[model samples]
Target: MSIDAFAATSLPVRVGVQIAPQHALYPKIREAVQEVEDLGVDVLFNWDHFFPLHGEPDGLHFEAWSLLAAWAEQTSRIELGPLVNCNTYRNPNLQADIARTIDHISGGRLIFGTGSGWFQRDYDEYGYEFGTAGQRLDALARDLPIIRDRWTKLNPAPVRDIPILIGGGGEKKTLRIVAEHASIWHSFSNTETLERKLGILAGHADAVGRDVREIEISTGVELDFSEGLLEAQHALGVRLFTVGLSGPDYDMAPVRRLLAWRDAANA
Candidate 1:
């Protein structure tokens, strides 16, 4: 579709929680997912990694897609998926099929967030080549359309057009991929960075003949959920705000605060 074909419209503010599966037991992580969902968060996310990204390198960690399958059966309202699945880890067609299966398990609530792999340890330890960033991105750009096509050829097909959330901030390649295939574009951006990137994304979207506004913008915040920062992002057209909750205890305070903020904003 043309970039201008879709009418500009305001989207409802939604809150997501990334329950980081690190330094915590699997049971605890499961409890955290239930707790966050019960608290009314709009989306639940986990990272696609084999090891902890922070704290002790040997900290407790779990795989993302497997946990997502379990979460699919465990929770009812919240949309769930990896914050970004690594494209290099599995075949793109297999990724599509797995996503489709998860969609059915969730009754159509899967959000297929993916990106080119980074984390060198994940590559080295897992025996996958940690190619240059540009090479990985080129692979990603090639695989995305194949993934989407595979979705169509699946036996039962996805329960819905599973929302594709491409997470990254690379101006040239990543944003172009987002423009071409993503239903949601996720990144970690402050107001100024988001504004500039959004302009660049618009150009890319226009180049691809897709509406930039049609791609939902998602960004993450840590413990300090600043209202001012969020308001600035919201003003710049970001609708999805995600907060990361880590390990062991899985604090619900920030999740509650963001949910309240979402309610207030939507109201």
Candidate 2:
């Protein structure tokens, strides 16, 4: 697909930042969240994990949903959620309830991004089974419907049909789930990968009898934006671009660059 193909839909390009909640204190994470919100990004995210993903394995790290609840109260305007919550950690119904509560807490600013669990350490430490990749994906598939059903039965419905963002690039399973359930599909694909995966996604959407473009395309961009990568992906229909920032410093230079790119693209 070319830029013109996506232009008709004209979804405004959005920028989000995933501030890794490892290797830093909660105060620093809070400060970073406030700063990112002040800078006018579209969304804020923290990963769902019990341990650090990089650097020192035993470094300081915080939980995902708990911090999201805190961030919901601390900031206004910016949408927030786990970059992708692990399905292995909690029951699907419980996940729905938790997301709904946070949705209320944030006054409906929550974007419920989730994926099949990947980090094995989290499962072992938490006493959940560290199953095969297929098993986890199968579990996620079985559970997502239940979550949506639970949403209907809740005391007070979500502030809105809280947008579900599904992150992963598995063509066989993950993309199909995105087709069936996700309002936003987040991936770490560049131009080539995105092009191919989107075709697969379209097929999945067809099987499910929905237009593929109804689901927004989200991607993680590299910090080095000098290469025209952003424009290339935009041409292929990706509107939501996010950058991942690690803790300790939580540098904002790249975030500023992404915001600038977003503004120019939207203009």
Candidate 3:
């Protein structure tokens, strides 16, 4: 499907911030979350990882779901989740239950972002098999249904049907899974890359008897929106864009830029 075939541009633009859970104390991370919410960010995300992705390797980093649980209580309005939770770390049923609990805690504000595990060091140190990429993708494919099924069986179910956000742009298995399962699809792509993948995703959606436009398109953004990258992507059906902030000092400037852009675009 061509970019013109999709209706993503008609959707409301949303801004998200990923508070990198590295190189900062827990209080600082929590403070940043509060500050971003106060600044009117639409969504808040933290990565699912055992260690910092950048800066000092052994830096102070906290766990993902635990922090999400904390944030569920800490904020009353903003939606929160892992930017992309690694499917390998916990059982599918457990993930579903945890997500359900957090959804209730947040009064139905969980986004449930997940992806195939990638960090080999995290897998090795955590004693999980650091399998081939295909194998991991296969595992994610198999587990997503189990997670969804588990949600149905839980007592006092999730406050709402949580939106599943799958991140990754692999043309084969990942896009297929996104077509079948994801309510939101996130990718780190420029205009060229995203346009191509939307075509692929449209094909997958066709195969699955789903409308490609039904899935919300998301991407990562930079501090500088002056280049018109965000607008270009928005033109191609991208609705949600996220900016990543790292700590010690989680600067709010980029977040402010994103929010300003979102407001202007929406207006």
Candidate 4:
């Protein structure tokens, strides 16, 4: 669950950008963030990791939520959050408290993106336990409800009811948690995998007495397959598609094309 960035829907089209916090200098990433929002992307995302996930392992990086606290204040229109934060990094109550603060920082434009812990490097390097996937997701399952409960009880409350975005495509556990807790569910699977997973997700939704449509389906665009994939996912009831690009030099050419397709598709 090392999502620091995600794409979101806005009006006739939805788009997003992620400025990899660990991979870039803060000022440059900050500038890129401002640029991304200026490009009219709906949501701005960042990942939660102590070290760089790609490129050099020992490259420079920054903490996830703190930068989000800054992002909350830095931009005015774009909704922002960690693409997906690791649930194991912070206690549920503390995470809720932090989210509440960032919620205010963005004047209620924050999306609380979270997921069951993954990325063993982040855990081990940070001195947190690298437990079994099931155990961590179980902690995540327990934690999400508590965070929501605490949100209801907190003073001043969240700036608004911050929307929750949960990532992962697991069957027995992860999707079940999404059915129970997520407002937006991000997936790495392409159309075929997404098509199959949708049924499983629906079963979980039905078991929990929840409507499948209540949780938004989200997928990614990697340039070559983006146009067709976005359309296919949209046909499968996914309106939110994210195109991820990371760098020393952030280029947004493909994002422009996807937005064009989205408008055409919805038209």
51 Cα displacement, candidate 3 (Å): 0.4
TM-scores of the candidates are 0.97, 0.96, 0.98, 0.93
Model 2 residue 132 distance off true place after TM-score fit, in angstroms: 0.8
Best by lDDT: 3
Q: Of models 3 and 4, which has the larger lDDT?
A: 3
* Cα distance off (Å), candidate 4, residue 93: 0.3
Instruction: Please write out the lDDT profile of model 3 over residues 235-264, one tens digit for every residue.
Output: 888888999999899999888888888899
lDDT, model 2, position 148: 94
lDDT of model 4 at position 232: 66
Question: On residues 1-267, what C-alpha lDDT tens digit does candidate 4 reach at each position?
Answer: 011111133324467666677666878888888887887788888888888888888888888898998888899999998888999999999999999999987888999999987888888778999889999989999999899999999998998888999999889999999989998888888778987788888888888888665667777667565466676677676767677766666677876777677667767
**Model 3 clash pairs?**
none
How would you order the candidates by lDDT, starting with the best? 3, 2, 1, 4
- Between prediction 1 and prediction 4, the one with superior TM-score is 1
| Cα error, candidate 3, residue 191 (Å) | 0.9
Q: Rate the local accuracy (lDDT) of all candidates.
A: 0.90, 0.90, 0.91, 0.81
Give me the candidate number with maximum TM-score. 3
Candidate that beats the other on lDDT, 2 or 4, i.e. the better one: 2
How many angstroms is residue 87 displaced in model 2 relative to the true structure, after the best TM-score fit?
0.8
By lDDT, the better pick of 1 and 4 is: 1
